[model samples]
Target: MPIFVVERRFADQLEASAERLDGINRINADEGVRWLFSFLSADKRKTYCLYEAPSPEAIRRAAQRADLPADVVTEVSGRLMPDGSPVPIR
Candidate 1:
């Protein structure tokens, strides 16, 4: 699985506006995607989610179901470990 960073802008819902995020979480679970963590911007108008998904399309579909604006999605690439160790090859 690969990691993706998604930034979302939610619709207005007054006090219940926060529920949009809950919906996103549920959709992610239903899609078999893992949400490593999420953060609300200091301004409280946007959100950032780090997810492990099988593909970009899966994440996109999940976002669509949540009804949140998927403003941006990027694939993250990195070594298996933080230490710059050589990768084992067959």
Candidate 2:
């Protein structure tokens, strides 16, 4: 699977409830996509999500099914740690 960074912009502040997350996760699994985690902006109107999927198309499909916005999906080679060390993503 490949790792992807997804950017989502919501018209209003996002409400991340457990029920909503569970539903999203279920949809993601159906598309072979895993929601690793997400970073939300201070205002909560924007989110940067990390996902592991077979392809960007899989993520898009999951997002569409979940009624979430997948504004941009880009593959990341790895991550740079706070210590300035480069780490490989699984």
Candidate 3:
């Protein structure tokens, strides 16, 4: 599996898009998405998403359903240690 991170700028339709993502996650079990984490900037005008999916395309489809900007989505690779810290050796 691969990880995709979406760096998002606020949009008028953000709330609606988030709602759609919830539904997508509920039904797309075969995609092997391990988890999805979303964070809102302190100013509330920006956001980011971390996703674990079987491949880049899986994340892409999920992002499209959520109305994420195509240019902002990117793939990343790494892992976390048992103590919840990212492995920095990469």
Index of the highest-TM-score prediction: 2
2 or 3, which is superior by lDDT? 2
Comparison by TM-score, 1 against 2, better one = 2
What is the alpha-carbon lDDT of model 2 when measured against the actual structure? 0.94
TM-score of each candidate structure, all chains considered together: 0.68, 0.92, 0.58
Per-residue lDDT of 1-90 in model 3, one digit per residue for the tens?
567777877654345466676676764454566456778787766778777777767766655664556447677876778989886322
- Evaluation by TM-score, superior candidate among 2 and 3: 2
Worst 10 residues of 1 by lDDT: 12-21
Clashing pairs in model 1, backbone N/Cα/C closer than 3 A:
none
Q: lDDT tens string, model 1, 1-90?
A: 788888877665223345765776889888878788878877667888888998878888887786666789988775355686755321
Choose the strongest candidate by lDDT.
2
The clash count for each model shown is 0, 0, 0
The whole-model lDDT of each prediction reads: 0.75, 0.94, 0.65
**Model 2: per-residue lDDT, tens digit, 33-52?**
99999999999999999999
